[model samples]
Target: MSPINFTHILTQAVDELSESESYKGLFHQHTDGNPLPSAHALCNIVELARAIIFPGYFGNSTVNSRTVTYHIGVNVERLFDLLADQIWAGLCFGGDGECNACNEYQREEAAQLAANFISRLPQLRRVLATDVEAAYNGDPAAHSFGEVISCYPAIRAISNYRIAHELLLLGVPLIPRIITEMAHSETGIDIHPGAQIGSYFTIDHGTGVVIGETCIIGNNVKLYQGVTLGAKSFPLDADGKPIKGIPRHPILEDDVIVYSNATILGRITVGRGATVGGNIWVTENVPAGARVVQRR
Candidate 1:
């Protein structure tokens, strides 16, 4: 070896071995980073799935039944592979170093669950198609189903929620929250993946809507902008720490319509076909067909 090359190698070795190459700048505060498959990657997968399911509505194409089947088949295969990898990453993220003996078993279980979720895509697409129809038919200015699929915030928000909710149900961790937050950042509609929302769900001008964890939403429910189905904060634990998970958020029965700027907290239920008017603060239950309007 040349003397110069040898000297350079030796210098690098010394610097690294002596800890002179401080990697302190590699990380910053406010990050306890669990490196894994990104939320963005999973988000793209959902986007692709939407395109596949809706075909020409989402992508620029002339989608016949044959093309539709082919697209869905390809998407399903890709979805399975991506789901397995991301779920594995999620398994390792909060649960470290192969975690426990149960971790391996759980990983297999989660994978099976994820595969099952992919299998349900047809059903999900069916329900989502209804959403697209609702959006198109509800809006007089909507030119076509294609317009609703491409431009509506409601469709976008609902798509994200459906994908994230499936992941959450499959016991795939971390990623679901990330996926939901991506939609939240984009649409200003925050629906927790853990929240159970039923079919025919509609959100009009969906900005600033916050649906919390443990919320059970019945079929045909509608929510408007600035509505918060949130939790009531109670006293801290004996250790003076905030509790992680509790049954805290509100529930909406079938056909409920919660309007703009309304804040419904705690375990209250807004019953069937009820219309909660704008700017109302509700902590108590509203019975069936109830109309809750703001005073003055």
Candidate 2:
């Protein structure tokens, strides 16, 4: 065979791929001087957040009453810095090709959003404490709150979810999804950042759990591994694309328990104090205090 013209072929391939039509809708053209969001920075932000929320368990092992305030104050300051940059990047990324004025506005907005998120840290910590307590108390194997915070995948996933959810609520674009996806990738737990989860939420053996967008889970809800709270079908627009921002996932009221591998679909409600047994598939509304299980 004749020798192949490798350089010529590569040049042709690059030329073809670089064509505007070929790369359109697939490429993000970043504006000059605008920083794109960094996954590494976000990872650090999440770590700092965890450290602040659970001081002794995560960042500083020697934290006590004397040093606790100092540790938290330092971490919070650092978190604000990192989170603000990422939030700015997210805004820049999703902005209509940036103007200098728009970029400046986004920068200011990002700082405000970061400060707001930081202010919510106390409330976030309170909610996470409930989650930790729920995990430790729900599982017989759990020995301590430290164990739940340090060891449980649910806590890790839920913390990310909580953080991301708050960011979503703050109107920061793109970054919240990225943060939750980071946790999902690490833990095999898929929680959409848009999901609304109340206090004392615990997921046992959390692998393969999927909580879809628009799922409203109330307080004291315990979900075992492999449970799926997903949409049955999406409502499409006139163009046949699935409509955005519709509430389609199931709602679990307070004190509900869904067992492993159970699949609950649609906009149904799992009423308060209900129990859904393992491997069951539910599409209808479950009554309050009822038990749902697969029939023999």
Candidate 3:
């Protein structure tokens, strides 16, 4: 048999891959001195956040009343340093073309944002406690809060969402989405950081749940698996591009429960104390306390 020329083939492939036109808009030109946002580092950040928020369940298993404050203090200090660097990386990656340099101002802003995010951790924990309570109370399968925290995909997904949401609020770009997406890949639930979710939110069998960007979900809301809060249609702009940043997803009021595989779309509202049954398509506003179901 003839000898195979692997080197020539690999060189040709490399040349093809290096073409500017082929890589245009697909490649990120990393000119800034700071590194790009690290998914690995963000994973560590998430772990630290979980540890701080839910003591003893994550990180150190021996955390108790006497040592809780000490553990949190150490975790918070480490989280601040790690988060500041990642935020700075995100800022550098997404900064304007004119601001290509990794300036001291960017670093300062990243540190300030990280501090603000740390400050919000207590509130985040408070809200997450509500979620844990809701999950425990709502699901017959859940025996305890510890089980919910340790075993449930919903907690993991929601924790990530809350973390990403806070980062988004702090105006840290790229990293927030990356944080949420990491959870999405692990758990089948997808929640956009821009979605406004209130307290006591719980997802039952949370896989396949998709909460779109701009979705406004109120307190005590429960969503079953495969529910999609999405846009019905795109509103095109003058250049025929989908209009950006308009309210496209549904508004789910407090005490609403959406059953599995239900698709609620558009700028419509699912009013307070409502129930949306499984496998239905709702594009219009549903009045408060109403129940929507698929045709018999």
Report the C-alpha lDDT of model 1 over 184-276, residue by residue, as the tens digit.
999999999999988888788889999999899998888889999999875579999877778899999998988899999998999999999
- lDDT of candidate 1? 0.80
- Most accurate candidate by lDDT: 3
Task: Give the distance in Å from residue 235's predicted Cα in candidate 2 to where it truly belongs.
Answer: 1.2
Q: What lDDT score belongs to each candidate, Candidate 1 first?
A: 0.80, 0.93, 0.94
lDDT of 2: 0.93
Ranking according to lDDT, highest score first: 3, 2, 1
Name the regions of candidate 2 deviating beyond 4 angstroms: 1-5, 95-101
- How does each model score on TM-score? 0.81, 0.95, 0.96
Give the deviation of candidate 2 from the true structure as CA RMSD.
1.9
Model 2: per-residue lDDT, tens digit, 1-296? 99876998899999999998897677776667878889999999999999999898888789999999999999999999999899888877754444233467888899999999999999999999999999999999999888888899999999999999999999988899999999999999999999999999999999999999999999999999999999999999999999999999999999999999999999999999999999989999999999999888
Error of 1 at 276 (Å): 0.7
Total clashes in model 1, counting residue pairs 3 or more apart in sequence or in different chains: 0
TM-score of 1: 0.81
